[model samples]
Target: MFDLIIRNGKLYDGTENPWTRLDIGIVSGKIANIGDLGHEQARIEIDAQGLAVAPGFIDTHVHSDLLCTKPEIHKIKVLQGVTTELLGQDGISVAPVSELTKPLWQKQLKGLNGDIGEWPWHSIDEYLKFLDKSNLAGNVVYLVPHGNIRTLVMGFAGRKATRNEMQQMRELVEEGMRQGAVGVSSGLIYPPNVFADKEELIEICKGAAKYDGCFVVHIRNESHRSLEALDEVIDVARQSGVCLHVSHFKVAGQINRDKYEKALAKMDAGRAEGIEITFDQYPYTAGSTVFHAILPPWMHSGGTSEMLERLKDPVIRQKVKEDFQSNLDYENWVLNCGWENIIIASVSTEKNKRLEGKNVLQLAEIKGVEPADAAFDLLLEENAGVTMVVHWGNEQDVIYGMKHPLQIVSSDGIFGGKPHPRLYGTYPRVLGRFVREKKALTLEQAIRKMSGAPAQLLRLKDRGFLREGYWADIVVFDPDTVLDRSTYEDPLQEPAGIHYVLVNGELTVKDGEYLGTTAGQVIRRKT
Candidate 1:
């Protein structure tokens, strides 16, 4: 007898191959058998006659570290059939934080990570323990946040690291790895992390290399200096002998749309020299982050409080606006893409709630102020606690990114209010729009990127493939009819055609409805 059985399904096997009719039996949450069993008995059996049975999807890039604090909103992910989420993205998260500095870091990260609720642990192991106490919608794997490490040693200072500071940073990373961080993540485009030089990055990556971990980077720039940033990451990988994975890889701005091939060619050249590199991209043309990211790196120095004070000065704010306006030669999102292309996604205060769906340009025109001034004032009012959807990615880039052999799928999903549609639509949209409709890729290839690819990247020996003896994390969906219903207007709408989902042999969603189960556990590094 088996705990559960799925019969008559077209199995993709999490690889680039045509589907084959197969029977999968689950016993004790691991795949126990994978052949036709005459007169097999089970407590529950699902007749997936026409559905595609594949490994549960893995979202490689996400900002769920802080948002996971709000469990009620996790249904958006469950409905999309995401069985695992790579948390602690962009080098920002809630572990390894000093209790003394945790309050400040939490305040500064509100725009990017949303609010950090009652889950407060200052060390990586403690954070994991806190997660274990709660039921999650999906499994979560963690990266040692580089920003948190930097802040622990330097407190958001904007400069090169001193020798002593460098040593301390390395020890912190080593400690995190000892506590089971799979790798270290860097957001070179963001503060504190941006302060470190290549040598400093190499040192931390070396710590990760000790455990056979990869260096996942949100590269420094994806616009004017995208190539330069790629080269820097490549150089770090080569020098430190660490594997590299780029997060949310994309070129931004209208003028930079054509740079994707060149950016990719640079990575290919590095790969030819024997450096292992992979990148993850969402299926959407627009990306979301804190609206405060529009400011130049220096403006963010001295922490969030200081930045707010600077924005209060009319002369300083005007100079900042002028600087952005005159810098169209680079990937300044607002300057190159215009404020109208940036839609406010959320705000922390009730006074700004009405602006969530509107663009800064619209708000500016209504308030009788320049768009830049309006943006600064809003950030000042909200204490920089704002998020936005920036429509800077080109459609051609998104398509080619999906087609790249080295590219994998991730949602980079953010949740709160009027969130990016990717939060609800990524996996289904890939199956529906890319595979079934446009034929950009075969269904097999799409499944490969979402399942096996990320599973391998994260080094999970027991998940990401529907094989005997592997954890029974699986999804059954009507490939032909699976569709992402979420749109830019109704960003919170649930998806369609996901018939069933299971995590660790437990049903989380059945018959297209969530069962409100939290069967997920913390995924740790094998070493």
Candidate 2:
């Protein structure tokens, strides 16, 4: 007898093949058989009625750092057919925290990820176990974040690391990988990380290379010097000989729209020269991040409290406003035109609740200040806890990236407050808007991007495909009807047509409702 069997489904199999009608048998949470198993017996069974079935989706790029407090985030993902989540994107997360740095790290990360509270810093391995023990609906994987280590040793300084600090950074990377991290992720656009020079990253990459881990980077300068930034990361791969993956790879700002193809060619050149490189893109054109990140890097040098203090200072505030006017980084970086382009997605304080859906320009209009000054004021008022969605990337760029063989899908999802629509709708939106509507990618190709491609990237042993002996992570959905319901204004809405989702042979979502079952495991890197 087996644990369960899902029968009569059209299986995509997570490859470059058409869906084939098949019956899947599950035993001990692994796929025991495919095709006819008419006589097989199981403890529990599901009749899929020939609806499309594929490997459960894997979100390669995500920021679910608050999983301990909000395991229901699995509902948001599993409901959309995501069975695994990779966290610790953009160089920051809760793990590897120390008694000295925990408070400071927590304060710094609040704006980027919603405050999950000051949880005690255990080792990264124990943190992952804590999440699994919380019973999240699906598996969790993580990348050792660069910012966490930097903060632990340097405390968000905007300068090069000392020789001693560099060694410490490398040792931390080794420690995190030893504790089961798949790789290292650097948020070069975020502070401390922004200050992390190429030599520092290349050395860390070499350290991660020792363990066969990929270096995931959110490269510096996605606008005016986007291609130059690409060259820097490519150079890092070249110097270290580590595999590289770019996060949410896109050119922001209106002026740089034409540079998308050139950016692709640069990455391709790196790939051609034998640097293993790939990228992840959400289906949507609008991207999300914390509003404060749009400001120049200098403002964030000393951690959140100090940053907030500077924001409140009239002289320092003028400098920020001047930078915005001078178009140093803000104008051509995230917000293309003005502050209104950045719609507020979330705010931590109830006092700033009304600002959640409004842009900085709108807030400024309400407060009778310039948009720059208003943004500064709001950050101070809320203690710098704010997130925003920037409507900037072109639909053409999104499609261009998604069509490339090297690129895969990732939500870069954040949670709580008014999160980005991708948090709820990334997978379905691709299946719905891009695949079904735009015809940019065939269903077979889209599934591979979400499943097989990511599994390969993570080097998973038994998941990401519909082959027997793989873990029974599967999704059954209606292709004709699957579509995202969330929008920029109402991002909390879930998608439609995801009928059933299974993680480790345990049904987590059935008939579009979460079963509240926690079968998720902390997927460790194979040493």
Tens-digit lDDT track for model 1 on 1-527? 99999999999898777888889999998999998955798998999999999999999888887655445778667678788888877787777888767887788777767765654688999988888777787888899889999999988898999878888888888889889888999988677787789989998898888888889999888887788889999999999888899999999876776678998998888889999889999989888988888887778787788889999888888778777978643347777678889999998899888899899889898779989888998898888899999988777779988899899999999877789999999999999999999999999999999999988888889889889999888999999899999999988888999999998899888988888888888888887
> Which portions of model 2 show Cα errors greater than 4 Å?
327-335
Model 2, span 143-259: residue lDDT tens: 999988888888878899988998998999999999999999998878778888899999888878989899988988777778889899999999988899999998887788988
Q: What is the TM-score of each candidate against the true structure?
A: 0.98, 0.97
Which candidate has the top score in TM-score? 1
Worst 10 residues of 1 by lDDT: 327-336
The models' CA-based lDDT, in order, is 0.86, 0.84
**Per-prediction RMSD in angstroms?**
1.4, 1.6
lDDT of 1: 0.86
Clashing pairs in 1: none
